[model samples]
Target: MRPAHLALAVLVAAVWGVNFTVIEIGLDRFPPLLFSALRFLAAAVPAVFLVGRPKVAWRWILAVGLVLGVAKFGLLFVGMDAGMPAGLSSLVLQIQAVFTALFAAAALGERPSRLGVTGMAVALAGIAVAAVDEGTTGPLTAFALVVAAAACWGASNVLTRRAAPPDALNFMVWVSTVPVLPLLLLSLWTEGPARDLEALRALDRQGAGTILYVAWITTVFGFGAWGLLLRRHPASTVAPFSLLVPVFGMTSAALFLGEPVTPLRWCAAVLLVGGVAVTSLAPRRGAPARRVDPDPAAADRAEVTPSR
Candidate 1:
């Protein structure tokens, strides 16, 4: 990657890293379901008009939205709200790589290389360490929710691969539409209509800013720049940068949110991030260079490796 693209990659990673803390901040004001719903809402809207529709089937678009937007994010926000630390949430979410790999193997019969297996083993070990730590310090239910979120992310990745939309950003924008109504109804069901109205009425500057940051900065600019990078370079070249997310996430959490980075957690971060890098960059003898779709969300969702 060129210096400019490298810089852009780092910038996107930082935006996504800081996103966890931002989500936490947003949840302080908006209920988790409402907060998540508002995120997709902010992402859709008039911009949808400007971006227009993707050249994909409606079924695939809506399916991707339900899995990616609704299931993955809903579980993540709820887990974080239930006391999962922002830094830890980001780290645990990396397990999506492992889940994606496993799902691909089972669903697509793409068996892993030896190196891939080893890398997944290392990452699983790291998760076990983190889970043990969480058991002692955080709510196990929250931990479980985050794990479910990772699984949903993995499933979304597979669905996106199957859909194989022509225009990534446009598909992402249209797909953003699917979650709005479902999430709104869920917000009303879980958080209640009264609480949702109260939160909206009481929305403040920080909360509003948080919502915009997630919609524009994280989802739009972050994924937008990333998609461009993948288009400009090989998936192998660009996908490795995802390893940096947890680094920024943990460091920023410590610096801004004052979340402590314990020795064990640090060890787990090393293992998890390193394992993902290995799995992502593992040599594939005689394998073709993975074709990077125009979709940024597809790239990020399938961070383990680019599709063959």
Candidate 2:
């Protein structure tokens, strides 16, 4: 990677990492589901028109939007609001790499290598440790919700890989549009019309600013830059930068939100991130040793790391 591209990769990781805190900030003003709806709404509009047509089938786009946007993000924000700390939420979500491997095996008939299996075990063990740590200090239900969000992320990764759209950025923009209505309907139904209305009535500059940050900074620029990096370089070179997310997440949380990173949490971070590294990097034994497809969408099948 060129020095500039390396910096850009780090910048994207930082944006994604610190985004947890941004999400935490957003939740203070809007109900979780409603905030999520607006986040996607801001992300999709106008930009959707700019991204050109969706390169993949609508079904794939719809599947990803529902799973990644609705289920994953909806659960993540609600989990944070329910008491999952931003840093730990960031850490736990890394489990998506493990879940993606498992889902690929089941759905796409792609098997993990022996080392990949080992990495999955190590990563799950790390989650167990993190669970034990969170149980001592936070709501177990909240942690579970984030884990479930990771599963949704994994499911969506498989869909994205299968979609193999030539233009990753366009696919994501269209996917962003799919979640808006479902999330708003869900918010109205579950969060209650009164609560949603109250939140809208209460919106201020800080609230709106946070929404734009998550929507444009993290969702639009973050994913767009990431897709560009993937197009410019191999997935192996780019994927490793994602390990920095939790590091930034935990540090930023401590500095900004005053969330303490316990020693146990540190241990969990090491295990989780390290396991993810191994899982993500190890090549399957039977697959031919070859270059990743030059197309960004196809390259992402092996490794696609998106923002929080």
Candidate 3:
């Protein structure tokens, strides 16, 4: 990869990492579900018109959208609002890789390599350490909610593999439209129509800015750049850059949110990030070694949601 492209990769990771704080900031103004609804609304609208529909059936798009957009993001924002620290939430959410591996084993009969299983075990143990630390550092409910989001993300990854849409960016943009109505309905139901109205009326510049950052910068630009980089280079070359996200997430959260990083928390971060790196970046044994272009859709689904 060129130095310029590498910088672009780092920039996208920074945007994604900082997004945890952005979501936290946005939630201060809009209720979680409503904020999420508006976020996707911003993501889908004009982009959908420009991108056109993906080649896959509408049902698949709807399926991926509901699971990825609504279920995963809804839980994520709600978790953050419930007191998941921005940096910690970013760290915890990477568990989706572990869950994805497990789900793929069961649902798709794609067996995990020994390295993958070991990496997941280390990652889970790290989560246990982080959870124990979080009991004092943050809300357990928040942690649990983020974990649930990771699970939903894992499920979405499986569904996406099953669907196997061509053109990931287009699929992502179009599927984004699927969640707008449902999330709005949910916002009205849980947040109450009156409160929802109040929240929208109360939206200040910060709230609006945060939503645009999430919608266009993180959701659109982050995924779009990643897909383009993958197209230009080998997955091995481009994919490893994702390891920088948690590093950026933690550092940015400390700077912006003043979230403390305890000694145990640092240890846990190392374990979790290292484990995920091993799980995602390691080569599998007994597999044919061939150079194939990474599937843009799979890459989109894998790194894309957590990048949210």
Best by lDDT: 2
On TM-score, the candidate that comes out on top is 2
Which candidate would rank higher by lDDT, 1 or 2? Answer: 2
Candidate 1: C-alpha RMSD to true structure equals: 3.5
TM-score of each candidate? 0.92, 0.96, 0.92
Clashing pairs in 3: none
Q: What order do you get sorting by lDDT, best first?
A: 2, 3, 1
Give the runs in model 1 whose Cα sits over 4 Å from its true position.
283-308
Per-residue lDDT of candidate 3, residues 159-189 (tens digit): 8767765566777788889889999999888
Residue 235 accuracy (lDDT) in model 1: 69
Model 3 residue 71 distance off true place after TM-score fit, in angstroms: 0.8
lDDT of 1 by residue, 186-225 (tens): 9999999999999999988998999999997887677667
lDDT of 1: 0.81
**Clashing residue pairs, backbone N/CA/C < 3 A, model 1:** none
TM-score of 3: 0.92
